[model samples]
Target: MSSWEIHAIKYADRNARVRGDSFVFDDNHDAPHPMDYFMWLLRRGEEVILVDTGYDDAEAAARARPIRLDPVVALAPLGVRPDQITKVIVTHLHYDHAGGLRLFPNATLHMQAAEMAYATGPCMCHDTLRMPFTADHVCEAVTRLFSGQVVFHDGDGQVAEGVTVHRIGGHSRGLQAVRVRTESGWMVLASDAAHFYENLFARKPFPIVVDVQDMLDGFDRLLGLASRPELIIPGHDPLVCKLFAPGVADHIRRLDPGPTGKVPR
Candidate 1:
């Protein structure tokens, strides 16, 4: 298997109160459940794959989610130019995940067929289900679809030599996660499938769920796909920023532990 360098670029975060039952399904605690937003960058040799194009300032202002930096701009520190990105794997069409699609003009978008149908389907006619999606974000995807920029998948498939995308619809109808073969092992990017480490480790589902059963099953799928528990990274967990590559000034983390036993010095 080919190994690649993976980096999670955190753009925004929020500290808010969350009800345990809503998030955990059974637990009853109501306390602060901090969440972070990020977009991942994967590089191997000359190929670059971006996972989830995070939302912009307008969406943040509308949703009242705090914004620190634009995800596209955040890539500057990693020496990645927007035009150089060839493939962008959208985990789902949630505004926070797919809003920045326009930034990468040259990339081919990868999305699950079920997810696109869900976003544009009659299910979104309901307010509760449509709240997480932004009209413009979904519309932009439609525009891309018409332009032949989208590569839609019915289920699971390899994204590249070492990267693969798997469908695990729960958080969203078309929700998917990316798994990359790295020096450490297979690191599964459990975007929204497991919002935080607690959600996965405790089998606690996050509040924003489409199908409880799908969400629960996705946890098992993630475990089976990953090489190890530690290698499976959560989508919005603040702990990820700290644990992966804490001391670095920039958020970029070299996931592959090369010959030195550590990728980053």
Candidate 2:
């Protein structure tokens, strides 16, 4: 078992337009807007793993959209510099998940092979499909791969001791979630596999899914992989911090520092 410290980094905020009926197959109800987020650092021994880099400040600001906060600025309180990150586990290649790759030059990125192909493949030729990501960000990741800064995962692989990556295709063909062994048991970081806890608890599916069946299947897999459903953390749910104990408050929270090592609470 490896001890770990997990943080819920608040990179950007959005009023997610969700359809109530869509989540429940009703197609007649409305779900309220919810918050968007990013995962921060996970420190274990000498390795520091960063889950996702929130949006780049300038790019997000240029959209002239309302954002609750800037991810970089949010990291200031924690004193985490971009280059200090040793590894970055990209949950997916969406603009929100992969936008901050340039921030850490020394870090080796862990991502799904299918995600890379999708972000840079022919499907992106269509405006509707490419609208979710910024071309520049995808280009940056491509450049990083060429420079040998990325380590692509073909499927499920162990990133670190007790930290496993589980491939679940739903939001994207290569979308994956991270499962870390915690003191309490196993905690699943359901990155985009299920955007909100309600989706899993209510047995509903989020509308913006690439494959509806795959998303549903992924949810089932997530539940089986974890010792407890409460340990599963949704990618975009703001309630994560509230659900888990506070170890590192401002930037991220420590869910459980397993038997591997101790993180000062």
Candidate 3:
């Protein structure tokens, strides 16, 4: 298997949030709990794979969530253009993660079959259930589907040599996590599987959940997919920037650890 280099590109954030907003049950529910939005980049040799394009300006305006930088502009410093991305793995069709589908015009989208069905299905009729999704984003995905630019994975599917996606339907009907073979070992990008370390460590599910039992099961699934607890990257914790790749000041942080016995220092 080819080892890959993973980078988390921070795009937007929600600062005025509390513990209660993040966790279903927490003692310090009144305490502050900020979220940092990110879109991961996985690269090896000449292969470039993107995971979950962050929301765009329109989404930002509608949701009242301001973006620090445009995701396309965020990629320029890294030398990756939106059109250059060949494969984009959308963990789920949540507004924050899948709103930028129109930006990547040439890339083939990879998503779980259930997610597509759920996003377009009757479940969206409920206001509470569909709050996290945007209609135009779903429409864009449908357009891509008709254009033959979408690949629907039933469950577990491989995107590249060492990159694979696993279906864990808790947060969404088809929410999946990306597991990549890295220098350290297997690293699982737990996109909304655990919004924060405490979400998994404390065994508490996020408030915005579709199925309570499945959300709890997904936490276990994230732990099982990763090589270790440390290798599992949470979806939206700001601590991720500090915990991984210390001394780096930029928004894009390196996630893969060094070899088994080798630390970054």
Candidate 4:
């Protein structure tokens, strides 16, 4: 029975008028102004696995333009320092997800080999695909790789005892998700495979995805890996906190924790 804690570190917010074709929607809908970015911290005993590193305060604020919040400030209450993180599991190379990588100097960064290649490769020249990334952020990752601080996983691989990384190419070439074996059941963190529950439940892919078919397939794979659907947590959905049971802290959500621990169906 392994115990784990998950925290959502919000960095910024943007008002996005989601159109019908945007993300499994037929009409314009008001969403919670997309939360800038968040990093999920999973703690099991002495192992501190960080999933995604939210943008750096200064750079994110500058790029976001009129930034609403700082991710580091949000993490202060959690008592998590950049240097304290043991491992960083990057879901992708998007600026929002990898901007803060430099902050964790001592942590071993993990990411998909394909993602790193694409991020640093010529495909980044495409307007649609390149708009979301920052050259500086990607360069930092490249530097880390050169320094041997970044560990690239070719496909599916295990990072720790109960933490596994599974590549799901859609949002990005090497986008991956993390799966953890918890006391109650297995929890699959669907990073960007399914940004919201509707995406998964309705079998729809987000408009920002690169390979729509791959995204859909990834969702299916995520579900198959989980012991139950309730054990899956979608990325960028505020309803995540509401769906899963509360953890040690108010912001932390526990995907598996016995009868009272399961996420609401």
Candidate 5:
């Protein structure tokens, strides 16, 4: 099996949030619950595959999100450049995940077929449904499709020798999760499938969801995909940084090693 080095790079964070903002059924609805935004980098020898490209400055300004670093800056310490990136596995089309689609000009994007359809299809017509996406980002994906730089997957797809993507729609119409093979074990990147460990452990769904049941099912799917529960990484959990040790830089956490200790209660 091909072992890949995976780094979770936190680019932005939102601290002005509450439990209600994160979970659909939290008893402490008014309590604070911060969210950290991240873009994962997967490396093997000289090859690199980026998981998601976080939104750029315009998005941050418009949305009132204080994104700390540009995707390029966040990745520079690890010796990864946007131009050198050859492949990108877009977990979904939500603004945070796919807003920077044009960043990696040379890379072929891997995505779920249903994602594009959902983004472009009638589902986006609703105001609430469309708020999470930026029109320009979706247009950029369309541009990639026209140029044959976008690779569409129906359900499960392989991005590389030991890295695979599985459709685990719920948050978005075609949300997917990336499963990677590491020396320690199989690490499943549960992007938005579980925003926090609570979402997975408590069997609860995140608030910004399209299909509640699919999100619930995806939790089990994430656990099953990994060699163990500790190998399952949540998408926007601040607890991730606390649970996993820093790598290369403080914000860059090495996920391939799995967690350093048990999740704090």
Candidate 6:
């Protein structure tokens, strides 16, 4: 089997209250929460595939989110320069996910067809539907489209010898997760499909959802693709850093789906 190394590079983090209900439907549990923002990098020899280009400094200021490091900067430790990137698999087009597209001038973007339609179509007429997306980010995608820099996929397919992207819309119109083959096994990069393991295991859904049912179903789809529940990585959970040791450089983790030490309570 093809072997690849996967790393979750945390660029920023936030301390906010994730109302239990904000992430769970019909639940009224209010609590303080810490969330981390990341852009995943998959490497096989010299080939590189980046999942989701994280938001830039401008977005951090506009959204009032603190950014510890830029996603592009985070890649330097791994020795991956933007120009070295060949393909970027966009899980979704939210500002935090697709805002940094311009950073990679040499990469071809891989996105879902349904997600493109949802981002560009009439659904954006509603403010609630468009709030999570940035107009400039969407516009950048349009420019990429015209320049033949964007590759659209309908459903699940291989991105490389060991990388696969699965379409499981829930948090957005065409949300997808990446499944990668590693020395440990197949690891699913469940980007926003389950922002926190608590959301998936506990059956709680994130409030910013397009189709609640799709989000709910996405959890199942994630499980199916990953096979083992623990192999799936949540998009915004700080526990990822805790469970996976940091790489030689800061904020980088090499995922290994093996026995873990005692987790802090």
Best by TM-score: 5
lDDT of 5 at 163: 95
The local distance difference test score of model 6 is 0.86
User: Which candidate, 1 or 4, would have the higher lDDT against the true structure?
Assistant: 1
What lDDT does the true structure give each of the candidates? 0.83, 0.75, 0.88, 0.75, 0.91, 0.86
Clashes of each: 1, 4, 0, 1, 0, 0
Looking at model 1, how many pairs of residues clash? 1
lDDT of 1 by residue, 151-180 (tens): 998879888998899999988989999999
Consecutive 10-residue window with the lowest summed lDDT within model 4? 28-37
Model 5 pairs in collision = none
Runs in model 6 deviating more than 4 A are 26-28, 257-259, 262-265
Winning candidate number (lDDT): 5
TM-score of each: 0.92, 0.88, 0.95, 0.88, 0.98, 0.95
Model 3 misplaced regions, further than 4 Å: 246-249, 258-265
- Tens-place lDDT per residue, model 5, 155-265, is 998989999999999999889999999988999999999999999999878888889999898888998999988888999999899888899987799988778989643
Q: lDDT of candidate 5?
A: 0.91
For candidate 1, the per-residue lDDT at 68 reads 88
Expressed as tens digits, the lDDT of each residue in 1-265 for candidate 4 is: 5656665555555555353434755455544335334578887767778898777667755775444445555566667777788689999988778877777788888999999888878888899999778888788888887788888899889898788899999999999999888775788888888777777877867878778889989988989988888777788766675656665555555555633444433
Instruction: Compute the lDDT of residue 234 as modeled in candidate 2.
Output: 82
Per-residue lDDT tens digits for candidate 2, residues 157-230, read 98999888988987787899998877678888898887877788777887667778989899899998887777
